[model samples]
Target: MTMPDINYDILRRVAETASAYRYKDIWITVGPEDGQLVIRVHDAKPTCEDCAIFPIAKVDYGSSPSVEVATIGSESNPVDLLNLEVPAGQMIPAGTYAADAVFWSQSAVEKFMIPYYASVYGDQADVVVQTLLTVLKPAAQDGSEPDPAFAIAHLPGSEYVTLANEGLPHLFLIRQSGRVEGAAKR
Candidate 1:
């Protein structure tokens, strides 16, 4: 199958826009069109912690970084970010407790987000990456899948994704009650 023609500069521009304006709840996805890549970024109003945020891509397992850039875009409504509320409280006793969780894995973030953030933030890119990592899961020294903290520090912006969209979009509908859509499965 052939791909679409993508305007890569657009992706870079969008990333620059996010950084300049400090948009929050940013959701980015990449697709192919006419032999090119079509990138989508769900833009949303900055969160309360708007002052700080997150990145895109700089990925590799055992390969050199590619020069390919994608065309980034947005739907009618973009995305909103969710942050962890560091509650002021006493320390809790350490004990084993089973729990459930759902999050974009650390490797996922690195493969998808790090490059984007690194594009703008340079060496300090991991700061926001770490932020999103916390919400998605836990931090790790090796920078692979995070150690599950059994909590979601961040989540999709429910406002733009569900309510504002006016219906069940494929993006959000893919996950229902912990069962990912068949297409999402390997």
Candidate 2:
């Protein structure tokens, strides 16, 4: 079994996009199980205590993280667990490949945490979005060479839009069905 080479920047960009909507934390997980590749995003919960309605009231508090995972495989070799196919012509080659997972929190306090005396608290969303966009553009440009046996579709029932482009080799946008199709060459 081998792991695929994952571009961390791309993963981080995806996480950042997901975090833009007030998610607590965003990170990526890449691993192998039963001769397959598994990718996951782990979203954390906010850390701040809920706003108090009554001055003397105590509110029960705890934080829990949410996780979303997607798996990919070859078009003809769909991953049974995820029902996704791999990109065309690319293979794992039976070796360990570099993988990266980044984690960051998006709590309101964490966003505005500054010295009590500091006069500046800027919105970090723009900065985060810019950085994420920069990282993602290159991957999108290089979409031509993605492994044929691997493809990713947004998790069902999630707000994420599926990614695909006409110029992307072995990848197709199923416009009518709104799904990404992979055509891997044997």
Per-prediction TM-score, please? 0.23, 0.20
| Candidate 1: worst-modelled 10 consecutive residues by lDDT | 90-99
Tens-digit lDDT track for model 1 on 9-60? 4445345434322323454444443443433444543232112223434333
User: Which predicted model would earn the best TM-score?
Assistant: 1
lDDT of each: 0.32, 0.29
**lDDT tens digits by residue: candidate 2, 95-157:** 111111211122322333222102211243444333222321223345673532122222221
Off by over 4 Å in 1: 1-15, 18-103, 138-186
Lowest lDDT block of 10, candidate 2: 50-59
In model 1, the Cα lDDT at residue 52 comes to: 22
TM-score of 2: 0.20
Candidate 1: deviation at residue 141, Å? 20
